[model samples]
Target: MHPSTPTITAQPSRPPPPPSPDKPPQTFLDLITSVLSLLLVSSLTVRSFIGRWQVIRTKLTSLQSSLSLLSDSPHWSQNPLLHTLLPSLLSTLQRLQSLSHQCTLSSFPGGKLLFQSDLDIASSSLSNHLHDLDLLLKSGVLHQSNAIVLSHPGPSSDKEELAFFVRDLFTRLQIGGVEFKKKALDSLIQILNDDEKSASLVAEEGSVGCLISLLDSHNERSIQEQAVLAVSILASGSDEARKTVFEEGGLGPLLRILDTGSMLLKEKAAIAIEVITAEPENGWAISAYGGVSLLIEACRSGSEATQTYAVGAIRNVAVVEDIKMALAEEGAVPVLVHLLVSGASAAQEKAAHCMAILASSGEYFRMLIIQEKGLQRLMDVIQSMPSSDTIEHVMRAISSLSVSDSTARILSSSTLFITRLSEFTKEGSLILQQISVSLLASLSISDGNKRAISGCVASLVKLMEVPKPAGIQEAATAALVSLLTVRSNRKELVRDEKSVMKLVQMLDPKRELVSKRFPVMVVVAVLTGGSGECRKRLLDAGAYQHLQRLEEMEVAGAKKAVQRLAGNKLKNIFSRTWRE
Candidate 1:
């Protein structure tokens, strides 16, 4: 084994070519190549780190400059700061645009939604800038509305500041001229078609009458429809404002809308008609303009709400006798009577009130009532329901009959008139009692009926003496006026200073209400009818000062009768005594 190992060792010995010393440790080229590889790698790493550092420094500098500019220029749009930073700001925007483009290229789902959200958030900052710029511009710190508009521009404003800017710009331009009016009307017309906008805000910005005028204009039908809705709002509020809406041809369009319009437009038009026709002037206008026939047609339509509104309009229009007769001639009474008998409580009330107004027009409505036998039905309602308003209606019907030849003849020929008249004195509500007393005074026109009503004279005397509510007192004063209208009744009933003095007390402005037409007229008559003793009592009650006020009122009243008959009119009747 030893001999074999020696031989193997001897064979292997080539000394492994001892390390190369004389060869200079392998050529310098190899060493150089290794060193160069390491050096190149290190240099690459340092260069990459320096590039990253430069990028970071640039971003930080841009951020600092932007903040500095924002602080230096509060109103960047109006001031010199915008120009100063324009280049940098534009560069930043370009960079952002490039970045956004790259982000879009990634094509991530919801990425666009995220972008818009960010844009919205960014708009708030822009809004601040816009508002600041606007204040500067408005305060004369800056000039040019167009400049502000250009600074903050869009079809729609995303920023509140931009909104203010847009609003100011629009206001200035819209108020400038007819050209502006057309522009504004066109813009509003477009906005009204937008589903996302607040309708009320758009409507308020559009003038009501302007919108109303559009109905007749060559403007698009869509624009006219919007205008009709705007006027409906104007008509629904205060008296003066409603008057303006009516005077502005608002009624014409509404009636037209009633004839040809969508359900919504028709509804809005009906509401406008209701408001306009609620007052006497507007009501008369509606009738004068042939609105009554259209309203009647609308009432007959299938739409329940339309019918209700139409009823209200009709009721308001019926206040005038000619209008009432016009409605009657158009066969509106039966329709109204049907509504009263078969409709909801509101419709019924409206119908009843309308019937009362129609009935109050004397002979104009008496034939209709007598022919329809509406008297018994009305009396039934008054006796059973006993509402104050219903009572007023019943009395008005009776009052109408008092002036009606056919009705009066029927009442006098039959015991029915006397019987009903007597019961009015016996069993009636306060207002009903007042009405009955008034009817008795009217019925007392006949010598025979005078004796029948004479029993209630003491009662009337007691009613006059006692303190009463204003409405009752007014009713009593009206009854007295009616009774005193007849010279025969005035001479017989106003016999003593006691009665005259009592009437003089009613002439006291403080004690008696003079606002109502009926009571004011009655007081005028009573003072005119009083004797010497009556005039003295009137003076004691300070009637002279009240008469002076009436003379000053000069409200086309019988001044001479009040002065000559009541003893105050003569004191200052057309004299300069009170003028100074």
Candidate 2:
């Protein structure tokens, strides 16, 4: 029967085979990438939305709530919130509005009214009202803007709280809105009309124009102090802000501050000016605005801090040729020399740094110093300055000069320079010693100065014999390497096996970490930085032997150092150096 029915058998239809296995995995990867992209987009959108919304929400909440409270009170026209809730209100908005309105018509010595037993009832009532307002602002419930506007008119009384309130309010207004900012300006105008609260609130958030207005306030002392603060804040904010500060009478204000303000104010002002001159773009403005004269005046001021800041500012400005010429025209060189001679350690250090910056382009600064007979002055400071900070600054300046042919000529003329340099190698501070070593090394690189630099080789080697800071040791090693690399100085730098051995001792694994230790890799770099002749001397002096023996003995530390020195390129150096 099956054979007979075979012709009638039917074929079954089958569903198509499932997609390839690789296709599923590829789809999953695509989906993951799409999801990550979507997530990133969502996060960026959310952050932007939040930032814009926060500002709008803060303003809306402040305006709506205050306006509502004002409308709700029946006594709005009579006592107002200032009289009714002044004592109890904790909102900064209410306190600020009340204080600002009150100060517009009333007179307070600084912005406060002192309490007295025999005071009128009105005065007592006002005092109570102010006390309430003060409490409210102090609660941090109000925007900083409102608080600043309230204190802008200076003080209503000579009370200490008034001064404190003004200072605090200024700090808060740094983030306030345009209207509150206007109030701040108005408050500054009022304060300038008085002697108390003369300090202008020119923090980073405020306008430079606001600070300049203080100069017209007739209160010279207040104008001077506030101008300094404002300028400093502007200089710290942005390059555009610095430009605005200058355009809005920053130069005169800075000069006036240096002339009249306290030592602290003068110091801050000089720092601000220096910051302004730090950029190449601002060079012209600084030179044109008579910055050099002002800086020189400050450098010659009685205050050591003022001199320090002034010298630093001058140095930064002198980076430009025109600025340096202006400083020279203003007789800054004499003032700098005088500072290097008789000033405090900080002052002398700054003066040296200034001289270096000015002398960097040519022998301008060096010639000026030498012409003023300043070598003795520098020598004295190097010998007597107690702080290592000053020595560091001076050494950097001198080293920078050593790289210049013109300044080298000036240095070569002074016998005291060589003598002092030798002494510096022997007994200088860690930083000073390093800088001196680098200076000598750089000097020896040139044929003309080789003899002068050679004179200090022995002393530099001797200094390496004692226990030293890692930075000093590293610098000495680098200097010696540089000296030996040069054909002229090589023999002199590593003349003795003891000299090589001293460097080897620096490689000792037991070198403990100081509070601020040099990187061990840095020592290695210095050791190997020299040319074939010098590197051979160093290795022969047992430097390579010491490292190899330490690698075998101090396995962990040696591994670390090796790994560090190798970095990403270490593999290549390893294959080359350790090949069988």
Candidate 3:
């Protein structure tokens, strides 16, 4: 036993012989616990995936419900009765529905990742369709229902039918919402523009009063513009309509619009005022309302078109003497002269015409134009060789300026001014030619200027000899008379036998010349008053018969001039033959 104990001590050191390398074997309870842990993890994962699938299914169901409602809802298509009444409206509704469906599809669940481009395209298409629908509603063209009502045979005249439609539209305008009011006003404008009878009927139906009321009541720019535009269309070329507009207290609103409205509104108001003021009485009404100052202000600051209209209105109002003086006092001359150079072509033309009228008022206004450098502007227009209409306007303005001796001297002294005037007389339009020669005649009043114009004697002679307008003949003949007053210029006229013949032919009673007869006779008398050679030239051109024919007419100055020429000729022939 001692030996065994000793061995056991030694064997303990060999101990618990190295632990086993294999894992420990599980018991029934351990196995059950491991299986339960594995099953718990697997069940958690499966439940998570199942929950995700159910969430996706719920989203899909909600999407399907929304799509079903969008496609089937009657509210999506408003006013089915309207659609039935207008087949085109039905098409619009269908298109809108289809577009809405497309938009919905492109914007759902995975749209950001899959259908973003489709969404943009659908959105753009929808916007364009909406714009088209708006235009269709606002254009005021006849709808299918309106056409059907109009084309139906009945006792109603077309005018009466149109009137009924107009009344209906106006009723809608007064009673409907903003969109309906706009559409009705748009329709009224179109109808009034197309049919004169419709314009008259609308005016007679108190549309002027309604439109004026709308101008004051509606703050919408589009509505106000359409209202003013309707007023303009109704008043255009219709005196009674214009009177109605005035009587309906439209003038104050029109002027207010011109004073404070937007640019478009002001433009429309300007056009309306322009139409209404076409009648002189209406013009006085505008002036009486202190509109001249407003119009002048427009000329000073409005857009080019507005400026043109404003200047034109000023010119129309200036036909009244008091208004003319009022405009001149309001500093219209400088504004008009400013417009002459800087305005649009139409504005410039109107400005020049306005200048012509203002200049014709008196020397004060004439000098006003000159002081404002209007003469330079007129000359610039000539030098630029503008359109025919512009040329006529500028030339007329120059003629008006030339009425004053001081202004004529100022105009005649510009560099190449006489040459420019002479060129116009030589080869410009008939109006240009007339105005040019008239300017020359005015310049000829200065003894120093006659020498400058004498160089153009040939052009002057040609103008007289050519078959020209009576105004051209009158102006050219008057210039000749003025030029012949200078002794040095008489030789040029006496040598041109064609000029002599033209002067003699002007005196022929058979021609029945009124404006140019006296001037032509005076020039002939001056030319023949000199010597036997001039008288011989006249006699050879049959001046005796033409001059004798003038004696029978009731022209006092022409008769005296012809008699003086006859007396000189007879005395010279008698003296020369007796001496020979």
The most accurate candidate by lDDT is: 3
Give the Cα error of residue 421 in candidate 3, in Å. 3.6
- What's the true lDDT of residue 457 in model 2? 60
Candidate 3 RMSD to the correct structure: 23.6
Q: Between the candidate structures 2 and 3, which one is better when assessed by lDDT?
A: 3
**Model 3 TM-score (2 dp):** 0.62
Compared with the true structure, all predictions reach lDDT values of 0.54, 0.53, 0.65
- Give per-residue CA lDDT, model 2, range 54-122, as digits (tens): 433344344344434444444333321232342222222222222323333343434333411212333
Q: Which candidate achieves the best TM-score against the true structure?
A: 3
Which run of 10 residues does model 2 get worst, by summed lDDT? Answer: 513-522
Worst 10 residues of 3 by lDDT: 9-18
In model 1, which regions exceed 4 Å deviation?
1-206, 213-230, 261-267, 302-304, 320-325, 384-387, 405-431, 440-462, 466-580
- For model 3, how does the per-residue alpha-carbon lDDT over 1-580 read when each residue is reduced to its tens digit? 4565443311101111212323221222233233323323332333222443243334334433432333343332332122222232223223323323333333234444344444345334434333433332432322324443223224445765666566556655653557877877877877766666666677775445767888873457778888988887777737778778878988889888999888888888888888777778777787778998899999999987789888878877877888888888888988988888888888888888888777777888887888888888888877877777888888887877776777667776764777777777767887788888887776735656676667667677667655656666656767777777777677766687766676667667777544445544555546654666666676677776766665666565656657656887788789999999
Cα-based lDDT at residue 525, candidate 1: 56
